[model samples]
Target: MAGYSLERLNFLVVDDNKHMRALVKTILHALGSKSVVEAADGADAFKELRHFPADIIICDWNMSPLDGLDFVRLVRTGKDSPNPFAAIIMLTGHTEMHRVVEARDAGVHEFLAKPISAKALYSRIRAIIERPRPFIRTATYFGPDRRRRQIEYKGRERRKTVKQEQVVDQSSVGLSQAEVEALLSG
Candidate 1:
């Protein structure tokens, strides 16, 4: 919303299904996005990354050979990842809490259930455009800070980095909390 333009932003849609890829591409185009890249799976996405760095990545969590989790882990933690900070959105059918937690830990910025709607997609895009989250790096993790803004919370902060409060560039390593809020609100 502040400095993002769909027509100017690059998007990478990763899925094993052709129809799903086409569907996402259509939605992106409708939103005025002109640069949309399609990847059949994580491997394909990895290859695409070499050619073009995406501003936003809409990927499915379930796939063959290279699943979304594997992809996210590699992207966020891989030493050779091109753009680790690129916003990642996981579009999947998995609705379990553990699965979502797994994805979040793998560095996914957004989680949208399958059978997605335009409103949900737009909301997520808006959130990323409006407010991106700070990136956090640790001995075992490299990605966006998983914590959301605490208006009021008495819960114990478990992560050792909770007190560090460090941030990295969006082009390097992390997902934005904006992505989660966008999907949740949707």
Candidate 2:
């Protein structure tokens, strides 16, 4: 315990159940986070994101209004706005491979099954922050010999853009600029 210390991380826990939210908040507090915000559902989560932007988001996948996948997609691809970068972890009860693939495609940083424990949450959070995912974009490299190489997101599908195409401002693409700014700051 000499060198071990809790990380001063900011977190947002989204769940429709009050008991579940409280449990997550307690875990976050035990982990040394001074700030933990709670949201009843995806709509509430989006509202919380607008104000108390979080460094990490742990959201239940079955909420009404927006649901976990929609939230992840909203924050990740920035639908109707700009892309935000806060690490997103989706909580789900299903272990289906297709579900996991869908989550990844929606830009989730990680997926966790239901009944999350403090140890699992902490470990996953540390791993994700230490080795954050990359956001790849296609670009044209003009060297002695002009050439173009497409950057891919590995497993995820992205807009196929031709080489040398001017990069569209992230804000101009999808999610609002304000939402993107909040995500970036988070």
Candidate 3:
């Protein structure tokens, strides 16, 4: 139900391929996302993040300018944390074991293989949003506009920052516990 509501999220789709970026924006719109922003690559994504951080990011992995893994790391460890602590879903053509492992290590919340299917995209989006995990564990998690006025009006407020890195379970991507067991059994 979380992802089923259009009123819930503002999304960002980052991919080097123009068509793919457009396609993702279209899909998110269809899914009822309030606003969808597109970025050509990770650099453009960083600019967008600075201006208005998105609730979710669906990015392509093999980009000419700043790959998806670097983007994920940047989001996870950046000084000025991006809004909503974007739930990142990496889009990749390669499903090679090493590539998948590398992506997981780099902090991607979900994976959507290339030639994106609607079902897969919806599944991943819902998985990330509907999960019980806390979205962000920081005090200063709101947008700059909102926080700026608050800072100006309320001089100083105690901010709680968590040092621990969020590690999402691999099984949460799309595979159910039983499905993982079955895959392992085979």
Candidate 4:
């Protein structure tokens, strides 16, 4: 929070609870973010995204008409997606391993458990800005790479190399490398 400013970033907060939305907005505003949009549900979020071009999306897990998982899927793979590469942070009270796996599988970039704190929120945003994951395109997945580690691979590659393309370009959605380094070092 001390090193970087969120003023250059645009954010979208999607949640079914009005209070929750307000709380998140307060946190974002306090962090120097002036461009924060709110959506009551995933459907509304999509509508807002069509015009907002959010740099990061903070969304809740449960909502009517469209849940967070479905929304993430659409944002990642839908033909009409406004910004498939936008970083997503899923906020939910469900801390179960299965729920986390489900959210990860649906293309969420970060998962934040509920009872949210400004510190936790800021940390998640920092992680996104500091280490943006490359997008991976496959027959079934077209979102950020699910892998989080760099363990050495001892086994031969099983999948065909042609079928997977790693998208490493982040110029359009985030700050340049120089900008990020300056912020982190400041």
**Residue range with the least summed lDDT across 10 consecutive positions in model 4:** 177-186
- What is the per-residue lDDT of model 4 for residues 122-152, given as tens digits with 9 covering 90 to 100? 9889989888887777877877777665545
Model 3's alpha-carbon lDDT is 0.68
Query: Tens-digit lDDT track for model 3 on 1-186?
Result: 332675667788889989998888887777777788888888789889887758878889877568887877778767765653577888887666567667766666677777787777888777766663444334433211111111233555444343346533333334555424432342
Listed in order, each prediction's TM-score against the native is 0.82, 0.69, 0.70, 0.84
Q: After superposition, how far is residue 66 of candidate 3 from its true place, in Å?
A: 0.9
Q: Compare candidates 3 and 4 on lDDT and give the better one.
A: 4
Q: Please report the candidate that would top TM-score against the real structure.
A: 4
For candidate 3, the C-alpha RMSD (Å) to the true structure equals 11.0
Q: After superposition, how far is residue 182 of candidate 1 from its true place, in Å?
A: 12
C-alpha local distance difference test of each model: 0.81, 0.65, 0.68, 0.84
Q: How high a TM-score does candidate 2 get?
A: 0.69
Pairwise TM-score winner, candidates 3 and 4 = 4
Better of 1 and 3 by lDDT: 1
Candidate 1, position 91, lDDT: 94
lDDT of 1 by residue, 115-176 (tens): 88888888778777766787877777788777644444567855545544354343432334
Ranking by lDDT: 4, 1, 3, 2
